[model samples]
Target: MTTDILIEHRRDIADLKQRIKNRRLQVLGLFGTPIVLAVVLLVWAGLKISFWLHSDTPSAINNILGGVVAFLVLSVIVQLVAEFSEDFDVWRDRKTSVRELNLQLSLAEERHILEARRRTPPSMDRQASYKERLPGEIARLRYESQHYRRVHLLMQWLLFVSSSAISAVTAWYDPPQPAKGVLIGLGFTVTVITAAAGYFKPRERAFNLQQTADSIEQHATALELGIAPYNAMEEASNLELFATTVEGLRADQRMREQQLDQPQQGQQHVI
Candidate 1:
């Protein structure tokens, strides 16, 4: 199915869900008044019974109680009748809507499955698969590397500036109690940020990721242009060498990641 159809189905599902929710709320409201009135009627009846047994009660009060009980009883009966009259139709329509929503959800899932299968690389044609996947892989790695690099740089700058500010504030200004407290808090912040930066090693991660991406791109380019290691061999052999080289680079990158994740005694370096 086309993406548009899947999107439309999703929209339909959402609309149906909202309709169902509104209908349920409406049904609750439709029945709620009668229940409340019934409770009121019961309370009034008890009051009426108590007043009837008392000889000192006023007749006017008895009349008012009788009128209120009658009104509550009538209101409850009317509300129940009206609600029951519409309940069956409302429930039937909601049920139909729910079924349609389920069907639409199923169709949307099927569309997603089909899209995934369409994008799956062929197992038999290794070269074709590589061509289909390498560019995207390279782009993703480069993007992540750049993201890490930017974060690392920002954290480093923040640490430097915060440290300098804390130093200047302490040495030059005695200031107020609140200002001193802020400086202390800033010092704590700097320490935490520095520790976190050291632990995460974003610089090392960025370097390794960028190197791997660049190495993969280089191999791909050489294979495409028929040069160096790829230039002297048959197409299949060249493809094999290219795949092995790329895989090795990826493995090395993974190893580096594992090393970074592990706590070391001293400073960690990218292997």
Candidate 2:
């Protein structure tokens, strides 16, 4: 009965990991195409705007205005897309968190089973079976968590670079008169600040991934010592630590959601 429960729990964890992996891939696919298109459009617009700004022809002003309008339209569209993508990422992360919580619950259950089985010394074959399988399960979870963290970090960096590029381009092509230039520079400064803030935002997934890795390392060490993990004093200590870490992550996630819900005061209209 205990073995069956353990197997079922392992399967549940495996399924959740697979779902998260697939969701990350889907997000990458959906946003990747649009980002590439946006970059291409931006580059084309930049070249055209540069040409128009440099020309001495009478129509240069009109051409420059048209290019600016086109760039603004495209920028707005890209910004909207980015907002949508961020919303999707939040939803996906919530789903991943729920799955992670479920996995942890399963691990707790498995620990209970191991505790029960430890009282009755198993045969060599049975002991060998667990020795072979437990490490693999722990390793797989660590790998999945690490991959998710990497993808998340990559997404943040991409947003930072893209937003900074957009702000720079806006400032370069539409250089304002002395008085207006100051206002434009201030606006650009705000955008740059926001982008930089995003890069430094607290990342719950990274924290959770690190906790998961630590848990796996503790489990592996316990297993190597021929210890029935759940019955080991150190193993129990590590599991409690893992639980505390996960709770901390959940609290941080709640705080972030609350911050997102609150409206910012005194921001100028971008349009």
lDDT of all predictions, in order shown? 0.75, 0.56
- Over the stretch 174-232, how does candidate 1's per-residue lDDT look in tens digits? 86887798798889989988998989999999999999999999989998899998896
Residues 1-271, candidate 2: write the lDDT tens digits. 6666666766766766666676565556455656666676676567657775565534665576667667656765654454466545434343244456556657766765675576443444444454456556556656766775676676567556656665666666675466356555655665665654455433544455456556556655655563544444664454444444444554654454455334443112211
Q: Tell me, what's the RMSD of every candidate?
A: 12.1, 17.3
**Candidate 2: stretches off by over 4 Å:** 1-128, 175-203, 226-271
Clash totals in order: 0, 0
Best by TM-score: 1
What are the models' TM-scores? 0.55, 0.30
TM-score of 1: 0.55
Best by lDDT: 1
What TM-score should be assigned to candidate 2?
Answer: 0.30
